[model samples]
Target: MSEQRETRQRYNEEFKRQTVKYIQEQTKTVTEIGEELNIPAKTLHSWLAKYRQFEDEPIINTEKVWEQERIIKEQNQQIDDLKEELAILKKAVHIFSNSKK
Candidate 1:
């Protein structure tokens, strides 16, 4: 019915955290939680499965995360320097225009 289509819902981070935790602690069925939260049951299962895998094999790559962040920062710095140069070139164009007048 059009009434169902008109209904809108959005879940916050805290809501999702609580739901996931409840599913883990209570060992309640995903179908049950999903129905209560109005989210698809399969989505809850996927999140639960992912959380279990992450818990079993935690990421121990602090160095890799730092390296990736460093690379991104360097690229951003280079882009900023290029923009400054472009601004200087624009200023030179205006200078030439004034000289012509």
Candidate 2:
């Protein structure tokens, strides 16, 4: 019987930092990026944790990510409000036009 051992791949600090930055960009989900880069989600999460732990590192700003999420939420709420207003106006117009006929 033959026994085989698996070898682990090592990544440098620079590569890890860049990967963390890429994740912060919010272009795609972690799962999608992991599949594309052939990296495990757990590894990517570990890199993110380390990146966030050191505040002095300027490679990626976690604040920016949170701010972007806030802005998106506000914009979506505004869109919903506008859509509701539009529907109400349309109904009012329909009712008024029918009364004249």
Candidate 3:
């Protein structure tokens, strides 16, 4: 019989930070974010606790939040424009198909 050795998964600091930030900003429980991200809930909780110990600061910076919101707004506008274009194309296709028939 061969003995099997299991290697532990290692997460970088940035990943840990982002996971904690998601938990703080998304209004989702730590367990929910952990499950969604495929990370163990206990591990995430420990990471968050460690982060809090190091710095009592908020997870996301105010400027970063504003920038993220602006980017999301711009992306949403682009999506709306694309949807309108798609609708116009659908209308044109319908008109052309009827004319052919």
TM-score ranking, high to low: 2, 3, 1
lDDT of 2 by residue, 1-101 (tens): 13323456689999998888878776788888999899999999999988744443445568988888999999999999999999999999999999999
CA deviation > 4 Å runs, candidate 1: 1-60
Better of 1 and 2 by lDDT: 2
Cα RMSDs, all models? 13.1, 9.7, 11.3
Clashes of 1: 0
Candidate 2: the clashing residue pairs are: none
Number of the top candidate by TM-score?
2
The candidate that achieves the highest lDDT relative to the unseen native structure: 2
lDDT of 3 by residue, 1-101 (tens): 13323456788998787777667676788888888988889998898886644343455789989999999999999999999999999999999999999
lDDT of 1 by residue, 1-101 (tens): 88887784666667666667777666567798788878898878766665543443337699978998999999999999999999999999999999999
Q: Considering lDDT, where higher is better, how would the candidates rank from best to worst?
A: 2, 3, 1
Q: In candidate 3, what residue range of length 10 has the lowest lDDT sum? A: 1-10
**lDDT score for residue 85 of model 1:** 100
- For each candidate, the alpha-carbon lDDT, in order, equals 0.77, 0.84, 0.81
